[model samples]
Target: MATPQWSKFFPDFYIERLWDKCIKCRRCVSECSYEAHIWDSKKKTLLEDHSKCVGCHRCEAFCPTKALIIKRHPSDFREHALWTPWFIKNIYKQADQGGVLLTSTGCALPYKNYFDHLVLDACQVTNPPIDPLREPMELRTYIGPKPESLEIEEVNGKFRLKKKLPPLIRVEAPILFAAMSYGAISLHVHQGLARAARDLGILYNTGEGGLHASLYEYGPNTIVQCASGRFGLHVDYLNAGVAIEIKIGQGAKPGIGGHLPGEKVTEEISKTRMIPVGSDALSPAPHHDIYSIEDLRGLIFALKEATEYKKLVFVKIAAVHNVAAIASGIVRAGADAVVIDGLKGGTGAAPTMFRDNIGIPIELAISAVDKRLRAEGIRHRTSIIASGGIRCSADVVKAIALGADAVYIGTAALIAVGCTMCQRCFTGKCPWGIATNNPELMKRLPPEVAYEKIYNLVKGWTHEIKEMLGAMGINSIESLKGNRDKLRAVGLTKEEMEILEVKHAGE
Candidate 1:
């Protein structure tokens, strides 16, 4: 195969530098992880190679003098309805590379987002809205099974319940930091998530990557994951967190497993993952032991046994067709919580086809699962924790109203800490330092700094959630769970509204 000449290739981004404002500080060159800006010693100035730019905008943000301007390339092929630029470019790149096209973060395809079509209701005459600032509002949530019926007995003057309650994981807010594992992101980022989760009184999932020894101190707020790969898994590791999440499938690549290239597996990551350094960590498509619901139930009990019944066990599955039925089975299998990850979920790396094509939206999945469980009289058996492309406080509120006990924020959390979503995480060259392990790149985002950013983001979102709850005349987040009447659909079809369990806007 003949290599395409540089002149024939199309560059996605074009860089413009204002030389008069440029201080010759060489900061852009140092800041760009892609090495797009090169110092031409002979020319005595900086020269940019646009082809190397992934459009992360790190250079533009770091330019001290505001001398850099990054924008889309002006050139383009003739436009066609069928052959859009995106498709044409994708084909060109694939034909050149002759391999699977990989991308990072959530699906970029323009699918109808159900959250946008749904609107919330506010109290007015009969049910007056409460002022969150003046009155108390509850966002605290518990994740685990609730007793079918509490047995009570009256003794003397005081009445007391008879049966003991099951173990539950409590959080100050219904928002959780989703799983982004080690070897996939820098340790500094992990530390930041852990510290923030602790301070905010919530939980952060330690993706499929095994728990790092340093983060063990934050175990109370951590949820360690056990994926098919079983990287860095052990007795102590299992007990290191408040809950254990069995990652059956993630939304980003529903039917596929995970692949962390050997190059990103450093010594520290190797130790944490219990994999040899410089070896690719691949999780099999399915857990060899869990081919049936009975097999899944066995593993759930095995983990409970491993933890001595001290920690809650969660089963996470991608939101796909018949998701409600799958969730029902998982609940009956004795999982304390069921995590439903939607199609828009983010990932460090995934085949472009799978990320864009697999899984259903979390909104519909949450509603379906909640309805199925309620119909089966097992709704209280497991908490529904929704994940995938959840953005902003409104999405969180909408998710709860759709039936999620809580929601997980993955991409949004990284964005809070300077991830530009350049789709370069798989390359291990994240310019903002959120996804890279390179020493220099890692220094760009210190744990303390990332922690502060994450803390502020979640705090702001929590405040907004409270305001929304108050507006709905509901003081507790629990009241919003599966309260579909609080929401109304706009452009959604009858089927969509039915699945979401929400009424039409006028009705």
Candidate 2:
């Protein structure tokens, strides 16, 4: 293809000097999308346009040319550091904020070995192992309230309904997509998640920003989130979903307000959120209506009433130091499920310090919260959904074994498409457009292709999870939940082992 006229305006320009290695194959020109090279038949010269090069290094990677060398344009960052006001101010601000700056997305932080520190147990020679392929492997799970005990009453040769609570919501699999706000991502990304969830028979959460009109068709698969901002929340919003999540705190930016800068608050985002255009959409640190657990119960009941008690209510809280106690309070606050987010969760944008530090890890938090709830005998009453830094099928299995009824994935879902975790999503300049709000960039992610990628990733993970469960001599996920008895902690302190309630191997 011929180089387009617009290539002249490219900011960076560099020449590749291929002296002895130029085979005159013309492969570089043929392979490059930018059309930066042209064959000069008369002079036997390969004319190149340095300006049009995108620096993708496609030619360099393929080039047999030990002779070709590409160098920078030399003006990358000549400006003095002290002159950049924004950089200086942020540096000082981060210095003042002692909290590990939290962020959302996949695990952007350095990987820790907490998950490896704990090990899953399988039946040895004493017990026979179940063959997952030949025998049945049950991964079916329910996400709502479970009856304390089913009571039967004989009435005229028929059983009467004696259970006072609602029926449990069953899912074939225990994995679900966590809420990623409509405004944070484009409509296509939301649709991709919605469609993928529907295909997989799992749930997808709508962040506090509210549901887009286009996604209303996939309502059954969606769990609408109601956070402090109350964006796009209404009676209809409440009624139009499988479940409602009350977002108390996000693992990414816990204890800090979320600010959708004026630049991203375009007309559509503004309308969906019921906020003014070009205004900063801020989510306060605390829900004004919920000052206490009793007050939280009031909000929960209000939503239940608005939804006619047809949907499950979930209270999502960041995994803090005292999260176990907080989770107990949430269960008492009338939540059908508790969604816990750990420190490694992703965010659209967060201060540097907050992203690096803040909150407890999901592994520790899940173990603690599960222990607390089980001790109180409320574990089975309300489901537990753990999120933040769930990178693969192993993490999901570990989480379920640790006590989570289900696992919520955020960043992993994005990675299935094209997110590089460049950590520049807040700037709205994502090259792949998965996290940006810009129309032109957003168009890069076609709904059909994006959905397929997400579906494939989830499907792959599901199969892997089944394999892991099968290897452990387990047939069902329910048998795995809070089955810490099957797990042993290695290289942990006495206090850590005590808190985790796991004994050393051979003990």
TM-score of each: 0.98, 0.81
Model 2 misplacement above 4 A: 1-112, 154-161
lDDT comparing candidate 1 with the true structure: 0.92
Q: Candidate 1, after superposition: displacement of residue 153 in Å?
A: 1.5
Alpha carbon lDDT of each predicted model? 0.92, 0.80
Model 1 misplaced regions, further than 4 Å: 5-8
RMSD of each: 1.2, 7.6
The digit string of per-residue lDDT tens for model 2 on 53-107 reads 5454545655666545556554343478565433443444456553444334544
Top-TM-score candidate index: 1
What are the clash counts of all predictions, listed in order?
Answer: 0, 13
